[model samples]
Target chain A: MPYKYIGRTHSFKGKTLWEIVGNLKNFGVGRLVVRNTVVERYPEPSYYRILKVETLPQPKEESLDNLRKVKVLLEKTFRGVTNPKPVCIESASYKTDYRLIPKDEEQRYCQYKAPVTNEKIFPSTMELPPLMKEVLIREMKIKGEPVVEPVMDIVYNDKKRRIAKEGEKPTIEIKIGLGKPAALSLYKGIKLE
Target chain B: MFALNVISKTLNLPATKSAVNFQILRWRRKPRWVPIAKSKQFRIPQRPVIIEDEQIELKRLFNNYRTQMKSIKRYIVERFVAARAITTDPKDIQRIFDEDFARCNKINDEWNSDIQSKRIEYFENTLEENINLAKESLQKRLELEQFKLEEAEKIVTEQKELSKTFITADNIDEAIERSLANPVDYNFAVDLDGNKFYNKKTL
Candidate 1:
């Protein structure tokens, strides 16, 4: 995995500019935003569409088809975007150095064989060009000034109440064994009021 | 003479000279007349014996007596003084022994007190040394804890760097807000010196 350094974004001249701090692998890429198109201004925008999509239903064949339609509509809407490159998420798979052959007659002699001439399948690690290295070092030298983060304030109130009722009586009974002196002094501090 | 010879024969007695001759003979033999040689058989060396004067003899006796008397007198005086001044009674002897015993015991007590004081001083010195050792151990433990904290912070920083790629400001702000919402389930308390500490856990 490549290392990434995220920086803060702030509004400058009514435009949100994000600063890239560490490695400049994707420096030219712009920010992503969402936009909507106006088709009609009627009583409601597809109430049945809302009820059908928002409610819970088992995602069987019909639901899968509906999801595909929604994906197609999204792709159609974003297909015209050329300024900010559309990002593609690569799916994970087992990366192998060689392809396996099961029915090759040469497998009796050799257990594994290359499907084709062993041309380098993956690109090798490349060193930065002289011009790019100079630019990278120049950009790395720009230190980011510290920014003060806003403090959050929270207040707490005590609104606790006991679960038992006020006039509740004890259900358990216990016979306490007390000595003579203890029994005489048990109620000595009580007031008549 | 006839009458005396008649008497000696009648009495059958030997004369004195004949008896002496009979006694000198070791073995009896037929009586024979032998003349004895009178020549000097042994020579004797003779020197004149000189006698001491009476006064010198008396002076020698006096000197002997004086030495003997002086020794006896000194012995008697020592015994008499011991009998008079220093009592031969058992109680006085026991009292003297008790005084000597007390003196020895006092000396022994002084030695013991000196040893006890030295032992106390040595014990205090060892205790102080042990305290210093304990303090050094505690200081090392604190330093180790501080090193571990720095290592943990470095790891956390590395992890954050690995996860931060191409993240927009809004996402970062959302993460910050989420982090602030939980706030580590703890309070940040400031001490009297304005140093912050976590109330829920050791830092």
Candidate 2:
């Protein structure tokens, strides 16, 4: 961690989230916080909850894979939790935000091995590219704008059912349990078109 | 995508077959670590110490906490719903929900710092031992993955005579074997995964 004049920011999807989640899979990340702005008014996510997986530095037994395992466990186990009303999830694990992700420091992620030479003499020169770096720093400026539209929408409706007999419409209160009671109740209340 | 495949191969596990990757998220900063001295007066109220985020292990523990809440809530809701089924009073439902929340929080309490510090110490010690062993084990296995274009290169180099009898789907051994050889009846054949294309076995 270095102290500099500014921070930079950038947006990534698909492989980006995968990389972050992958890094977390083996190692652990700190508690992620989001802007209240991002949490509310994001029409998609009805409930919001952030996840933390255990990671230890010692005997080095804890693997990022443990985080991955846990991610799977949560999603699989909670699949039914947020079904009818999806909870829009926006996740970030930052050394700093993309907007603060300065330009020059973008490409410096950890390198595993040197790019391999193809002469075949011993291809021993081959190497795995180091982990990715925060690259928005070099090519572009980190501009601020309205937060991007929400990206993740997880549903928490595992136990929804109609109590009304075929024709006799029923008024029911179903608690799917994504963990935000207020949001869950409000979402279930808005008239469905 | 490229990296995913690399990891899958490195782990020697089937790619995304049954695995689910989870992410750990921590507060932008260190969580206020409760002081070592257990408070007695509701314990003396004190401000959270905002130290520079240290302890990578502590952060990992938090990520699991973030993700598991959904499941814990579900378990609570299950009991909530089941309890409600027994009676429809609003207060009853509220009581059940409270009970559920309390239980979930209680389970979370088990992973508190008091217990985790030790787990971290043990986990880290074991990790170093494993990494060295892993490096040695993986050294012998060639980790080369031919980029897609390399596939064509391999075909040309391995088989100068590209025209083939076995390569074409029309000439596949399975299809050929299934052709009827008997006068009025035919024997049905299935492939290794035990899936039948067209059952030739007569009822």
Candidate 3:
């Protein structure tokens, strides 16, 4: 079988495997280091289709000779001072692949779909249940004007309570929790597809 | 412009140097900086400087299209006259306009495709050039590091070898006598100020 080379590899046991040096994932000829956190991920394995391949032109002889001279100078200068090690030169080409998802597959999955429903319930058009709406209005006295007024009143009362407690040397803790109706509505149908 | 110096074959019996040195003379005259006329430097400006943000590029593109349309219209009129297909009917005029519009659109598409191909060629060339440059630089850096390591190794090996041939106490007296007997004069002399001065040998 022909060897498939990706980067610097080392022999472990009897198999030639990719070498992981420090934080770098090294293949026999190439290595890569993560430049950023994985902001995106695939739920399943994906394949990339090769488009075009190109051979880069070789560097000029003059430049190569200059490199050799620099190498010789460095070797001569540090010969007695340090242990010799291989100096790896890394290069990378960005492989930009357009995910070739089938048209029908895209139409089926790349869209918002409501949880399996027996009745026709478009999530976008779904309205709040009447009972929940009444309860919300009654509990919060929400009349469509300003929600900020009530929020300010809560903060003011909390501050007053803290001041009164400071004089009495008592600790007051405030714990906030989601209301039952809101929590139920939020998580009842969403399956995180 | 260079002049090649040639030695006469009789004078040297043979050409002394295989390669001839060509003396290159300065062709272009040296440019001397001339100060701007004092009158022009202090001239009062007739126009006031104005700066404004405007869609200059979009306006230019539209202007170019308008000019192209005008030229096309003129060409169509001339071609129709030459072909002797004169018609005054509004319907016929509208049909001609429609046909020309399609032809113009086709030409535009061809031009756009040509531009795209040219752009792709330029991009590929640029990519290759950039890769070559980067690879060369990286190789040079790696070589430098390796050279440094090799030099360090050489120094250490030499030092170790020298240490192995340490002078014994028994030979120290003989070594001093040998050095004093075969004393060599210093080629360069240093004065009281610690600066080395080369000795000039007299004929």
Candidate 4:
């Protein structure tokens, strides 16, 4: 496989790869090499792709030896390249990319019918049911909008209160249980980011 | 424009380097005065400046689309004429419009598909290239690691052999430390850059 840039963005600084290109409009570089990151992993040394850029520096040699010199050097360098590749002379650029997410799998669900629902069942006399909410940040975001990483917290609790009768001037009594609300928070990240 | 230098059947191109754009830090002042020790500069009228590549690309894209729209007007007028020239047969004109719209949609679909195919091909090539490079590098690393492991294995074997040859100073620790100080080719050392040692003679 050939090297390909995943994205043009360098989300991480200084770790980006660059391909050396010739400035054809002015000085024509004889050969170009891409600057690659070094791979230190082994059985062999991990290699960041390195593009070599070499050009003849001269008061303009009158012969065709300019290309020959580069050719010779390249020929000497890549002696074992069985499938010698040609370089893209016009434009030489590599993409330095940020991390990417993996693709999602296809939707697959197994249909199963459990027993019928029990209408009358309670874990305890003082247990509160769970409540879930779907929240959305319905707003148009600009480029420099502050990024807020949402935090989620879950809690559970039970409420205990006595019944009240207004006719006898009775008052309502309430007690806080040790258990908190069993909740899960879903934060909406900034969109149009 | 540059001078072309030909050498050994190849032309040498002048490589132009990127020049640093001078940055003049500016701020507002209340007409302050400074002596020889200080250098105060005056501010000019404020104007917009191009600071990023995105702006340049946006401008180019806008101009391109504008030019394309200008060129596409003839087709729009033709369609309008065809639509207006109908009086007796309304269905025919509607059919004409429908046909025209369908044709347009088909044309668009075709064009898009064509461009998308090319883009996909480009991406595929790019992906392949990168994958290959990565694979190559990974394979090389694996080999190097294996080589290192083999070297380590050799060190162990060498110690075993030396144990038979003669009991060294303090088991293998002293021997290994001495070896490390001298630094024999353990085969763990690797330079991926493949940079040849610079030679003045070669230059």
- Residue-level lDDT of model 3, residues B44-126, one tens digit each, is 44554332222343454454445434444554465577878758999999999999999999999999999999999999999
Model 3 iRMSD vs. native: 32.7
lDDT of each: 0.41, 0.40, 0.42, 0.39
lDDT of 2 by residue, B1-203 (tens): 55556566777886546224623355586457855443452443454553333333345445434434444455446657886675579898899889999999998887686688898999999999999889976764434344555787888877876565345676676555655553433455679999755545544
lDDT (Cα, 0-100) at B150 in candidate 1: 100
* Candidate 2 positional error at A97, Å: 18
Provide DockQ values for all models, in the order shown: 0.00, 0.01, 0.00, 0.00
In Å, candidate 2's interface RMSD is 18.0
Second chain TM-score, each model: 0.34, 0.19, 0.32, 0.29
Better of 3 and 4 by TM-score: 3
Residue B202's lDDT within candidate 1 is 56
The sequence of per-residue lDDT tens digits that candidate 1 reaches over residues A49-165 is 000111123236643113211110111113222223223211110111111112243224232333454322211112233453455456556645343221111111222422223
DockQ, cand. 4 = 0.00
Write one digit per residue (lDDT tens) for candidate 3, span A139-181: 5565554332111011221222233222343232221222222
**Candidate 2: which docking quality band?**
incorrect
Model 3, B104: alpha-carbon shift in Å?
1.6
